[model samples]
Target: MLPLVHNELYVEFNDEKQGPFYPAEGPIPFGKFRKHKKSSVELKADRIGELAKTISLPRSALSGINGSDQALLAQANIVQMEKPKSMPFDDSPFLQSTTFKNKLDAKTAIADYLGKPLSRLTDLQIVAINMILDETLDKKTVMDKIRAYFTLSSAGHSGGD
Candidate 1:
């Protein structure tokens, strides 16, 4: 519900999936807005696809509750509203793994094939090398893919090997 304008109560409508829309321009009175779907909360996976209910308590609703209970309820509501934070990117797992060694070997091989230092390789060249290396880092496989990429890049075609 929005603030009263000239003693008339106003309310806003918002659809979770489509977001809020202004019908007849801005907030309408509760009676003026048509109700659909009856307003239900749906629990879904992290990805979008269902309606999520927002837990909000108006000041009047919380006024009657005892301080301790109100604090607990507020904490619980906050927990429900917050999304879990993800761990930042880290390479510790591959620091000394065989996959790490293979990646290094692949990078070196690509640099050698292109007759350039690894740091001197362009972003596109590095990405092309990594794309092939991701499939299989065998020397022959890497060489063949790099050759294909080189051919395409030289032929005025790009982005695909």
Candidate 2:
């Protein structure tokens, strides 16, 4: 049986307000949800295609967060072409150092994105790393262009020569 769903959508145009006798969307204004708790966005299947158009803050904008937040923010698949990863709490020295609070996770993610072991990075990959370290490349762009072939082919293309 189809469950009865509420229709509380309300809208106001330039001249007047529009609403059902009982609004389906809002009796109250939407406010910042409690932090660190999972929240589900309810949408009809047909409307979900619009969800892809939504976005959060950019990677550089995420840089000012605290250590744990910075690490968590690092592993997010902000790169449109990449898949999100399930990374553990990496406590490696490379990350423990002030430079890379999330470097270990980033390294693991880059390795997985390239389908190669971290130990086998090519010279081009090294160049990409240098570029990333020097802020010449955005990590998101690097991952987005991971297998883009012609774009960074001179630097490297995924794994192997």
Give the winner by TM-score: 1
Q: Global lDDT of each model?
A: 0.65, 0.58
Clashes (backbone N, CA, C under 3 Å), per candidate, total 0, 6
Clashes of 2: 6
Q: lDDT per residue, candidate 1, 1-161, as tens digits?
A: 86655443345557335424345456566778665533344323422343234455767565665667758888888533456798998888766443325788778767777887867666887787778888886766667778888877779865543
The list of candidate 1 runs beyond 4 A from truth reads 1-101, 157-161
Compute the lDDT of residue 1 as modeled in candidate 2: 85
Clashing pairs in 2: 7-24, 8-23, 8-24, 8-25, 9-24, 9-25
Q: Each candidate: RMSD to true structure?
A: 20.1, 26.7
> Candidate 2 — which residues are off by over 4 angstroms?
1-101, 136-139, 145-151, 154-160
The C-alpha TM-scores of every prediction are 0.33, 0.27
Scored by lDDT, the top model is 1
Clashing pairs in 1: none
